[model samples]
Structures are given as C-alpha cells and as structure tokens.
Target: MKLRSYLYIAFTGTLIATTFSCTKLNEEFRGELEEADAGNIDPAALLINAYSSLNTPYQQEQRWVLQEISTDAAMAPTRGGDWDDNGMHRAIHLHTWNADNGYMNNTFVSLGTAIYNATNVLRFNPSNQQIAEARFIRALTMFDMLDLYGVVPIREGESLEDFRIAPEVLQPEAAIDYIVKELNEIITDLPNNGPTAAYVANKNAARTLLMKVYLNKGTFINRQSPTFAAEDMNQVITLANEITNSAKYTLSVAGKYFDNFAPDNDTKSTENIFTLFNKNGERGGNVDRTWNTVAHYNMRPGGWNGWCTLSDYYDKFAEGDERRGIYYDYAADTTSNRSKNFKRQNVGFFAGQQYNWTTNQPLMARNPSTAPLVFTREVTIRTSGATLETAGIRPVKYAFDYAVTGQRNNDWVVFRYADVLLMQAEAMLRGGTGTAAEALDLVNDIRVNRGVTLFTALTLDNLLDERARELYWEGWRRQDLIRFGKFLEAWQEKAADPDPKTLVYPIPSQQIAVNPNLVQNSGY
Candidate 1:
C-alpha cells in the first residue's frame, strides 16, 4: 500500500505528557493521545494523510486488475504473461468474484487499515466539518469492503483492537443503510467543492460516494432498493448539478484526455473530487506511472515494453470510440510513425521475462508477478525500442516523466466527477425512474468534449459497451457487468466460465486461515 501520511501536527494545547490517561480504560490505551487532545489536531492535515493512504495498495490491486482487466479498456495475453487472468480480469473486472479467487484479502485488509487509521483521527474533537469528513472516509472504506466481500464486520474505533466487525453475514442492504445515514448526516458538513485535486471531501464528494452507494445498491445493498430513488439518485444528480451550477469545479474544455491520468497532472485534476495525494518529492508520489507502462520506459534505456491492451477488450470498442486511440495504440502504427512510446512497468528488468542481468527490465523473470500483457502483441512479438509506441496494446493514458530524478511519483484520483456522471446514468438505467437519457447523454457529453462522436443508442447493452469504452480502465467494470445482468452471459474464450457462482469472490483463503470465524464463499 502507498504510504498515507495524513499526519496530525501537535497543536498549541495538546495533552501534557503523562497527564492524560483515563483510569477506566486499560493503562496501555490510556498513555496514548486522548480524546480531548484530538481537538487540537489539524483537520486539514489529518484529511490529507487519510487521502494519501488510499494510493499505495491501489497500484497493484486497483490500477491494474480492478479497472483495466475488468473494463473492456485493456486485457492480458492468454499465452505470455501473468496477466493471463484477463478473463478473470474481465471476470473480476466484470464483477464475478467467486469463492476460489483470492481478491478479498488485499481489498479488505487495505481498506480496513484505512478505516482503522481514519477512525483513529476520530479521536480529535473535530469541527462538525471534520467529523463529517472523517465519518465519510471511514464509511467509504467499509463500503469498499461491503461491495467486494459482502458481509464485513463493520469495524470502528481508534485502534485495531478497539475496531469491531462481527463474523455475522452482514447483508448488502444493511450496508447501504449505514452508508446513506453516515453521508446524510455528514453531507452538510463537507466543504464546498474546491479547485484542488488533492484531498478535499466536500458535500459534492460525499454525495458522489453516496450516489455510488445507491448506484450499486441493487446488487450489494438490496436488490429491492431502487437504483433511481429520488432520495438516492438525486444525491448524484444534485451533486453533479452543484458542480455544474456552481463554478466550484469545471471539466477541461480543451479535453486533453491524457491529462486526467498524467503523472504531473495529479494535484490539479479538476474533475477529480477525491484522490490519493502524490507529488514529485514524496517517496510514493508520482509512483503510479512507475508501475504502469507509462513510467517504466523512463528508466529503461532499452525501452521497457509498455502495458499491452488485450485484443478481446480492444475489440469491444467501436471504431468511433476515440478512447481506443487515446488509451491504447496499435503496434503497427508505432512502427509506421517510427516512434517508441515511453510506457513502463513496476517491476522492471529482473521482473518476469528471460532477460539478462540489468537493473531495469520490468519483465525480467520475477517470481511474484508474471507481468500480464495489457494488449496481445506483447506476448507474440518483441518490438525494437525504435518502433513507434503505437505498436502494442498497452495503456497510454498515464504520463511519464523522464525528467524526474528517480521514481516518478504522483497521486491518483480515486473518485472523480466523471465517475459520478456514469453512476448517475447507471442508477437511471436500472430503476427507470430518473432521466435515463440525461444519464446516457452525460456519457456522450464526455465523449463530445473529447472530440469523439456521441453514443447514439442507449440500451442496457449499449451503455455497458459505452462504459467499457469510456471508463474501461477506471475500475468500475466488474460491478458494471453484474448490475447490468451480463455476469451470467456466455463468453467464448473464458473456458466453461458459465457458472454464475463466480459472482462474489471468495474471502481470501489466507484470511480464513487466520480467522476461522471467516467462512469461505461457496464453490471455492
């Protein structure tokens, strides 16, 4: 996980050393910071740290698999790399987590830790504003757990020991209630949407997350829960309106699509409502591009191969889908242009390929990561560095900085306004209550803004396909598939993958080993 340094500076009147332990509490717990001292902690600083923590682990679990694999945006080669699980990538991306695959471990643990730490900040007597922000963060983490794992013991409290989540099967419906209640109480407390791309959980951000709570409401929280509840769907609509109505946030008019993922653009993401903070100097800052195909090329003089986009996924995009050109390029085109696109891998030289000793080859035979191909050509052919980067099917969205002294570091936007636009649309589709056309229109609005043709049709299949093209690698694909009813459909290449039992992934086997109370999902 990326380091979350949401640090709390000791304020003017923090508890005097050794004088603040409550006798009723255990002595061990008493010596640490007290509830009273929390009042002195800075809310802004605490919030920054909390946001920074979101990035670390995502580079692996989220950036690569959750978004890219699941979305039709990219895929792994069946023959060559570790990413061969792209079917499962689509499976996992498509939201079919069964008992057998081990997805929950990293998800639950990482989010749980964030909740733990964020809850710890709950110690400081926060401004009602801070209270609202802190509550939203903690609740968001649990919701993450709730979405993937299903019944998580909703842990709370300052320390891990003090945290609580029972082994009981927590239903999705119940989880939604918790999320709604928390956000409603805190939404008023969130700051007005601001211009900074870093940590800023204002009312709109809260609403956006809450809308997500509702958008995925059917499958996770309650199937009976209408996706377009005036109460629920409006949160998204209202919030999106708030941004558009108010000048607080603005979508880029020039529509430089790549800027959204560029390493340097991290802090200035106007559409990004919330993010994992990273910058040039910090250790993990700008660190994402390092693991992505965009970054490794910076360090490899031999031109480390970029993330290959899978043919299956690439096929999902219609020729009109401009994102295909923006996010991934055909290897043949790069050769024609006589250029080498500079994308990189996290585990460079000495990673997983049969390359000789060099400190910087991402594919150099690493044991843990087989380095899946983002596109197919990566496995079948090796391109000379001189070739135009358009050759292979890897992600070209994230920017690289050869100028950076070492590991190029920058924060990643976890949730953004564009996501809210899509979620609002999905809720409309499922419930048929809101403006489905408006929902669908917002997507094409993005495409139009990007100089791409607007999506003309708006069927469930069409929207899913559009989502795959527009938001493919953004990490919403898995849940998108299930909610749209495609999780059970037959796909030719997945190898007898028809069993719908694959929907809810198993809690990692390792987690069960540690806590016997944690039962495995069925069919593991």
Candidate 2:
C-alpha cells in the first residue's frame, strides 16, 4: 500500500528537513517538532505525506487485517492466519470482539502515528491549505480508531514521538466535535479537482467521511439520544446526493459492473473516491491479497482457500443475477465438473513473494514430485488442510493475476461507486425518511441490468443480502452488521459466549506499555 512506502518516498526529505524546522518552535515542549534538517522541505508537503500514510496494506479499506472476526467473514487457513490465533491478534479479536487490544491497538497506534505527523506539521502553520488536508486525513484515520475503540486519548501536538509519549488520556465529546468541526475547513479548502481524483482527498471524500462521523457520533461515543442522529442522516443524505448527482463519476457502465473493481483497469476510473494508490512499478505493500484471499483457480494453482462465501449466502440470489456471479466463480475441471469458486487469488510462486500468501511448499497435486519449480509459478496442491476438495469451492471474486510483479499487484480494488450508491440508500433507510422501495430498485437496477431471470420484490433482508453479494470482502461487513444491530448478537451466538463482551476490540499491549495514560476498552 502507499502508506507503507511513505516513510521512504513520502517523507524522507521532509523528515530530514524537519530537523531545520526545529528552530522555528520555542525551546519548550514544541521544541522537538521545531528542530529542522537543512533540506528546507515544504511543511505542507510533509502533511500531504502524512495523509498518504493511511493507505497501508494492513489498514486499507479491504481490511486485510481486521475482517477475521467479522460475522460473515473470517481469517482463512485457521492456524496459518496470524492474529487469528490466541498469541495476540486472535485473543484480542476472535476471543473477544468488543474490547480494545491487539489488532484494535495496532490500528489505533498506526493512525495515531499518522495523526501525530499531521499535527506536528499543522502546528507550524494550522491555517495552511495543506494543514486542512492533513487534518482531514487524521480525522479519517481517527474515525477508524474511535469507532472501533471508544473514548481514546486525543492529545495533538508535535512529532510522531512527541504526540505518542504525551499520554493516552481519555477524550471528552469535544474531541469528536473537533473532528467534525475540522471537516468544514477541509471540504472548503480541498480542490474541486485535486491530484489524481481517484486517490487524493477532495471535497466529496471529506463529505463522505463527514457523513460517517455524524452517523455514528452517538453510538460510537456515549453521546446521547439515538446513536444515528436524524440531523446526521440529513447531512449524510445531502452528501451522498451530491456525489450521485455529480457527472464527474457515475456507476459502472452497464454490465461491466466489475470494472469498478477490476484492479489493473482502474488507473483512472470514475468510481474511486479514495483508495490506497499503487503505481504498478512503485508498490511496496502486498495489497493484492484481498483478491487472492477469495480468487478462482485460474488466477492461482490448487485454487484459493474458498473461505468467506458459502452456499447458504450464495443461495439468496435469483437465477442469472449478475450481482450473484460477482460473488462466486465457477470453473470446469479437466473432467468437466463445475467447480464452485468462492475465494479469489493473486498469482505467484510458492510462498508467493508478491501476492501469494505462502510458497514454502508447492501445492503437491498441481506439480510433479520431480518437477523443477520456478518462482512465481504456482504448483498443484495435494488436497488437505486449506486446499479444497474437487467438488468444494474456491475463492472467486477478488482474484487477479500479477505476472509482472512477484507480490505487488496494482490490482486490489478498495473503494467503488456501487458502494457509494448503497451507502446513500442505507443512509436514507436508516435516516427514516426513505422507503425500502427505492433501496430495492437501486439493487434491482444492477441485478436486472446484469440479466436477472427472475426479480423478486426486495425487502430489508433482501437488501442486506444484496449488500453481502455486492460488497463482500470490500471490508464493510462488520460495520454493516453493527449498523444492522446484528454484530454483537450473531457473533455472540456463533462463538457461544455466555456473556458476549465483544462490541469492540482491545487496545494493543505494545501501545499500553508505551502509553500508561491510555486505558483499555471495557471487558478486555
């Protein structure tokens, strides 16, 4: 992802030059940030660098790291998935969903680092246009941390280390207010047409984030009244409508719905709002795994793990629904059996150096025992743990081939326009002024346009299922379930927790060790 390499390309000059800025601040606490390198790099560019930090592979919208505990999603390969076990990630995320620890803390701490960088640069000049953009980026990352783990410490000042050491002091509601209040500035200041409209922060990106912040203002924090405020809905709907009405971007052209998500093709697609930007040759993060995690066999040998999508969920689609095909992949074996592909893949050799998850052992079945193997070439697999049976399913939708790069495929689809439409519909439905009919029609448009044989009247359940079909693995399931009021309950019943103390994850221990003032979320 863009954020990983940011420490390298994004801030090398600024970080070095930042030493010179040191003289700009007073000798007191702000002194650390004031130090400067002789490079004289623009502080605004530093803030832009900070915004780019959020596009990390671990923390991107597909949530390669966070989806394991979701109700409809899970970490594939069981023991193979790190943080999926009791060591740290699993204990904090899987064992308990509500508390803050491990995965939650890592996400918090990473975002905190970005915030600290942004704030440090902003401190030099808060009124600068770049400062506003930096603040917007910080706000976006903070939303992920705050909503996932409530009442986090919100100290803002200089340097990554300075803000980090300050304290984990709990924030008042004003802290949340500060984020929302700051967006007005960002929205006004960001360009009507910014750098690479698909990836950079723009007016609409600011608005979309504003909608999210307001929608969860009450529930995420212990505010008051309904968690989703009526006023918040109005703002959200207005923003969604603005994006919808804009001729700048629209839904995927007719039947090429997947075009919105087809990775290599979206170098300049209209649907993208903000995604982890990856130039084919510049990739430093392994982002294509989201597709690899649920891809079909043609993309990789021995097929993918076929983990998330299942027949139960797949059965909801009416015959010939194009949306349904998007979720599942079917391949014919040499013998002509229809292979149900649920998981998708990114190509690579054993222990795929680029997008392949593991390549230590060649999938034995796909290759001769005496065959000499080459890197990036996928060998066949002997059906066993993780490998699917002939009649079983393989991941399909998210799969892609990256022959050029070993592990860095510029093919991961993060944000899409279809999702924008659904968000608009959900905001309308939850806002209480909209009817299910409109939502139904929105879904049917995609289905019918895609050549659905039979269209049934849509209901709330149908809409939710449609979302699962349309947005699977794009990383909205957990939030969708929470909004649906089904996360705590379904996961609780599934895990059989006598008292399900999971609504959020626990703070990471590494962070707690560093910041004592920070308190872990309840029931950790």
Candidate 3:
C-alpha cells in the first residue's frame, strides 16, 4: 500500500523530535528530517522507537480486540450504551464486519505504522544487532497483518520521495515465505534468552515464532479447510525442539501459573519466552487493561466492566484447573509509594459475586442499587437484565498490580514456553513425526502442571480444547479456531458463518481507496 507523504513526514518528524528531545524546529523543516544528516542520528533511538511502536497494536484495544472479540474465547458485549462503539463489538463477535469496520481499519493502520517504524531503522546506520532487532519487529508486524488480513504490504527501503508509489502486497503464501526467511536470517544476531532478553528480539523467541509460522502456515494458505503439510509440521517440531534444547525455559507450576502474568513476571515467570516490558509510572503498553477491561466497577481497583469469555469457552476448563481462577495475595507494602491500600480479590475467572478485597465485603452493582456485583455466565450481545452490569465470565489473566498506582509493571506475554510445548505436541500429532504416545505425554505434562488430570489419549479436538483452557484471553483464540477448522461454527452469542470468506478480514476500504494494489478480501 502507498504510504501517504504527509503521514510519512509526520511520523518521521515526531520520531526525530522525540528521540533527539528537540523542543523547537523551523517551520520549513517541520516534517523534514534530512537524509544527508542520517550519520549523526542515533540508531539506538530509532530502534527504541521501533520497539515502542508495538505497544498499541499488541495491547488492549487494536489487535487484541480483533483477535479475542472475534473468537469464542472473548467478546465485548454492548452493555446498554457502554462499549457500543456504533455496533463495532457486536459486528466482530457476530462475524458481520465489513471493510468499513472501525476496529479493522484502526488495527490495519496500527500494524502498518509499526511495520513502517521498524523498517525505517534499517535505512539508518544501525549496528548488526540493531538491524536484526528492527527486522524482527518488522517481520512480527507483517506476520500479524498476514494473519489478520491475509495479505501484507511490503515497502522495502522506500524513501519519503517514493511515498506515492504503492508497495508490493504479499499474498498469504508469499507473506509466509517472507516472514520465515526474515526470522531465519536474523536468528544468529538476535540475543539469547535471558532475564534482560525477554523483552528483546532473542533466538528462542525467533524459534518460537518460526514454530507458529510453520504450525499455522497451512491455515494461512487455506483457512476454510486447512491441511497441515507434513513438511511444515515437521518444521514446527524441529523449531520447537530447538527452543526446548535452549534449556532456558520451563512451565510455571500449579499455584504459580498466574506468575507468568504478574507485575514482577520479568523475574518470576519461567515460561515467558518473549514479552513487552512495562515499568510502573514509566513506559510500556497499558498491561493493567488486562484486568480493567473485564472487571466490574465496584470491585477493588474499579474497572470499565467490559469484555468477557463465553460460557462455552469457560466450560472447557475442568475443576481445579489453576488457570480457571485462584486467590492471589498481593500484600500491601507500607514502605513503597506504588503500593495501594487495596488488594486483588482473585486472579483468574470471575463468575460469581465480586468483592472488595480490603474490606472483605461483596461489591454492589452500580447500575442496580444494593445488589451484589455477580458476574454471570449468561450474557447476551445486548444485555438488559439483573446481570446487565456484570454479565459474562470475567477473566483477569494478568494479576492486578496493587503496588503500581498508574501504569503497571506486568510485562505483556507474547510467547511462552508452555505455548512452545503445545505447538510441539500439536506438530507431532498432526505430522506423525513422533508417536501419539509422545504427543500425549507432552500434553499431559502441561495438564499435570496446571492441576488437571492427565489424558489417556489425545486428539486434535482435545488438543484444541486444551489450548483454550490453557491460553484463554491471551489472544490466540481466533487463529486457533480457524486452524482447527472450527472458526465458522456457532458458539454462545455468535452464529455459525458458512461463508469461508469470513476467515479473512476485509482490507480496510480506506487502504484500497488510497492504493490500487490493495484489494478487499473475498466476502466483504
């Protein structure tokens, strides 16, 4: 797609101005950062900007909204007027979205902007490590674009003067190849997994991403009836094995499962392979939105009372699964200014009466005076009943940061070791590269850790259900559902969409309007 000249100039000016801490600039040079002076620019600053660009798309609103709300795992129902957003949430959950959808348009733009910012780093005098990091970021954004839109616009080394020229669009197959090639080439220069490297582009992270690409490449190529080629599945197994051999990661056990998403997860989580770092009152994605988005207003550390999982998805979790819900203690710190007087009531699914942790009193629903705030399992698209204010099963994936008052310290998890294990098991199951016993063993290991019973046997259906139970609301539901050939099936509030074209989202109409090379997906 063509990058508009004004937008390019504005982006460059903003990045340059922010990176250099320049408070003033002449009107004539306002949006022009001269290419001739590129030698003097700090490559590190540009790289930092590339990393920072990922915050919005991966966080609560843009990409997460598209990935989660459109699947059976989660939905943001319109509570009376709140979260209506002109039926955007309803359209996504119901699979009625068109090219004009605001969420789709914004997500497309955000991913595109992130790609541009990362690509901009390559044009500067960056070191080998910096170049690798930039390419990884660019590849990631491209992968997301490919996954969500079934196509990707690639602008290679384009200058501001060439902004009018539309970039070549890579179809699903070509996009997969391009991303695979980029990740493979950059693996050596990427950092090795470590405490400080979780937020950076690392070797294990690349391996994990490669596994995802290979595992889902079939679905990307043919979402309607995905056929996992033996070769691709083998590649997934191989890459997953590489990450396993790193000896740098392990699953967080029962009781500690929530630690992977805790405020201090950078140091506490053994499962996180790649994450976005957030520091209290500093810089990072709004990780606190993990709780605020689904929590009730009367609950301690009041939330917006939006977004929740369907009853069908919630039913997948068996009893005593630590991932379902568990009480987590965040004892108040008297000495730290960041710590609050209140604590979190629980850290997983909130299905019944909510409470104020500080007072041990049931939280009362704001809309219905004197009624307990009981989050219900039965929620409709347009809720209007006794449970209007607390409909659906609320998920608190990330533990509340009682310590941090504003921005949280929770590092948003992108890749985890548990996921790596699951992918490996799935690849083995699909490709027959390893015995069924081996695959069953791998899956049961995770189940055991999560406080669930070991399975006597394994199947694609059970594996898909296991993924849902283990990774709900972490933003892989839609992709997983599509890969399993069940995305179009009906569940909870959403109806079955027989049209295969619904598998891929429409290219934003505005994008197609600007760039003739862009075409809308089939069913839009």
Candidate 4:
C-alpha cells in the first residue's frame, strides 16, 4: 500500500479567520475558491482535508465510544472522579442520551466536517481520480452519519446559507440509494487492489462500502421492521464475491493475526481493505487510544485505565482462542520506572489478584480496594459515584506502541477481508441465494483459523456472538446488534425496555438549531 503521509494544508489566513467568525456570528461560510482562482492551491490537498476529517471522529475514540461503549461489547467506566465526562459515557451505555450529549454532538460535527471538506474537493475541476476519491470519502461519511443520525446533510455547491435553509435530508432509503449510486458510478475510476492501494479507496474498498450499505439498508431504512430485502442481500453477496474473487486479501490467523493491528500492520497484514494511515507524532492519530484506554498507569508506556470490556461479552470467546490475547505480565513501578514489580494484562478481560513480578506480592489499586486491584467480571453499567480503578476487566484489543509518545504508529483498520467474509455469510443466511450450511462454513473458517471452537449450528444469536468475538472493539458491535434485532435488548447494566428511537442518535441539538430543515430522529 502507498504510505499515505498525513499532510496539513492551511487555507488563507483571512478565509479561516472569517470562517470562525462567521460561525460565531450565525452566518454561513463557504469555501468558494474556483479552480482558476485557486492559484497555487493543490487540488489534492483539498481531498486530503476530507481524508483528514476521518481523524476528527476516530481521533479521540468518539466513534468507538458511540459504537462499542454504547453496546454490550464495551464501556467507559467512570473510575471515581476519572472518565466522568459529565455523565456522557454512562448515558450512552444506559441508552439515556439526550440530544445535547457531548459525544453524540461531536460525532455529528465530525461527520459534517467530512462532508464539507469532500464538497470542497468536488468544487474544483479536479481529475477523475480526485473526484472519485472525494466522492468515495463523502459517501462513506454520509453512510455512517445517516446510519447513526438517520439523516444526512449533503452540502451542495459553494453556498452553505442556501443549502441550510431547507436542506434536503437523505433518510435511510434515500441515503443508501445516493451512496450506492455514487460508489457504482466511481468504482471503475478507482485504483485496483494491490500493495499500493491500502489507505486510499480502491474498487474493492468501494465494493466493501457498498456491501456494508446494502447489508444494513434494511436496518437503516426501518429499524422497527428491519426486513432484509432480497435485492439488497443479493447486492451484498455479489459485492462480497467481487472482493473475495479478486484474491487480493485473506484472513489473518494465529501468530500473524495481531499483525493486523501492530505498529507495522500496514506492511504485515494482508487483510486490511481500508485503513487510516498513521505515523506517530507526525499528525495526531488514534491508535494510541485503543491501548491507552485499557493499560494500567503502572505498566510501561502507561494507559488511562478508563475503558474495559463487559464480562458477558468477554465470555463469548472460547477458552483457547488466540484472539482472546489477554495475559498477565510484569507491570512497571511508576515511582522508580522499574518493570519487575507488578503484573500487567492486555486484551480481552482482566480479573483476579494482580501480582508483582519481583516479589510476587499484591500491588495496591489507586481506588483503595481491599483486595489487590482485583478487576471484577461484574460492573455497574452506570458508574455515577466513585468507581474503583480495578472495577472491570480492561480490554487492550490492539497492539500498543510502547515505543512512541502520545500517538502510536499502528494503522487503524476500518475494513478487513474477514469482515467481508462474515458479511457474505450474513447475507447468505439472511435470505440471500446461498445456503445456511455455506454460511456456517464461512464463519467456521474464521473461527478454526483464529484457534477458537467452531459451532455445529448457526443461529442468529450465535452469529451475533461470533461477530462480537471476532470483531470486538473494531466498531461494528452497535451495527451488528441493531441488525440482529438486539440493540434495545437489556444486557449487563442497560435497560431492555429502551425506546425504539434509541436505534438512531438524535440529530445533534446544535445541528437542528443551525438548520431548521434537519429533523431529529424519531424518539429524541
């Protein structure tokens, strides 16, 4: 894959200053520079802005919290005074979030910025490749925005004020149609899958995006009814076939499975279809948050000790699955910077008494637990008051970059072939042309290779569990739960009787405030 350098290009100072002031003055600002007037501005840089906007959503783990933390797969426990972002984290887990919830609002803004930047690229008379890549990024952004918010604000040509007035909102069907049309029109212009095609969108990447949109079209259109259309499922199957038949990807297994997330994953993993390229400290990136959220402060290259996997979800993995990669190791003494004192754990769930590697003694937790920082299997979904440091089993799913400061060099995988295969299996089982036996085999292939026990039969519930085990912390949990008709089901500390409106996030309060045409999702 081409090493995508994260480049920051600054527009004119006057333009930026005016734009910020316009936001405060309640006036719309537009990037209206024409191709001729662009002077020395590189058209590719504008598209880079669109790609950079991805960092905005995934940067601070906002999407992960929305997708994984809100679902039963994971949670950001409020450890006492820490991680209590004004109850935002807790609200998501409990499905009690309102329109003003900070994280939801941030997500709304981040995706909107992606649309704006992509539109900027389209405004210029760029080459076909630039146009396709910009539209692909725009389509991907809109798909997620529509999926989560149930409405997409398409920023039409060079005029934000006019566009906002009676902004055309693309609801589920309209959004999917729009995205599918965009991908289909541009797939031929995209680059083919190869070593030079990792970070950028390729034909397979577009197909994968189309597959995802088609697979979840039913849920996006009507979460309440959510009847999988045969045509959509067939589209999913067809697209999956294109990706698999290309033979450009494979399922990473056992010893090499972790390579998909390690610091050098971009070079080692053959499975990543679309991923965010990151070089530590060059431009701020997100791989750090994956490990930082779970690693103990006492461990070398310490973590925030905030987020952890829910125990019930942890149990989904079979006993000897290599994917269940958590194990206790030596922890470092922060006071003296020595590593021989306490045991550190990574990935999956951590529990029981943590031991010091030096004297094999119990180390005290910061939260003053009676036991030696024993992380428990059970945790309150809503941690309102004091939450102990060792309350839940920390999940360190991605390989941590202990070598870097602040940011990690690991490339974040957005779509992998394994996920593509599973999507095909899902399409087959969900009323597509393929047989159930074939679907089970597709899933078992992943399971056996990952060194996990295989299922004799595949139930809808079983498939959901398999997805959780295989793709946990990769940001597919919420989507999977909703499609499987289980998003509103009660689990761990969440309420089963959640409102159907909870399926889609409320159109952020600020968005509705700015654009009256934007309607809030049903039950906000």
Q: Which candidate is the best by lDDT?
A: 3
Q: Supply the TM-score for candidate 1.
A: 0.72
lDDT of 4 by residue, 332-357 (tens): 12322235433344444556665543
| Model 3 C-alpha lDDT per residue in residues 290-358, reported as the tens digit of each score | 878888887667889889988888889888888998766543222222244344437788888876665
Q: Provide the overall lDDT of each model, using Cα atoms, as 2-decimal numbers.
A: 0.52, 0.50, 0.80, 0.74
Per-candidate clashes, comma-separated: 64, 57, 1, 4
Stretches of candidate 1 exceeding 4 Å from the true structure: 1-48, 60-64, 67-73, 76-103, 157-169, 222-235, 266-268, 283-286, 289-307, 318-322, 326-392, 407-409, 431-440, 490-493, 513-517
- RMSD of candidate 1 to the truth, in angstroms, is 8.5
After best superposition, candidate 2 residue 143: deviation in angstroms? Answer: 0.6
**Root mean square deviation (Cα) for candidate 2:** 8.0
Candidate 3 ranges beyond 4 A from true positions: 1-31, 159-161, 330-345
Model 1 Cα lDDT, one tens digit per residue, 1-524: 23234444432111111111112343334345444365565666655455544564465454235434543344433324433443444345344554435445555555655564465556655678777877877777777767666655443333233312223334667767877888888877777755363455677777677777766665674322224455555555665666566565555444354455555454445676766555555534434443454323333333444444545666765554445543222221222112444322212112122222233233322222344312223332233332323234554444444445665544555666666666667656655356667777877777676566677766677777767766655666666776666655544233434555555556776556544446775567
Which candidate's TM-score is highest? 3
Cα shift from native, residue 263, model 1 (Å): 3.4
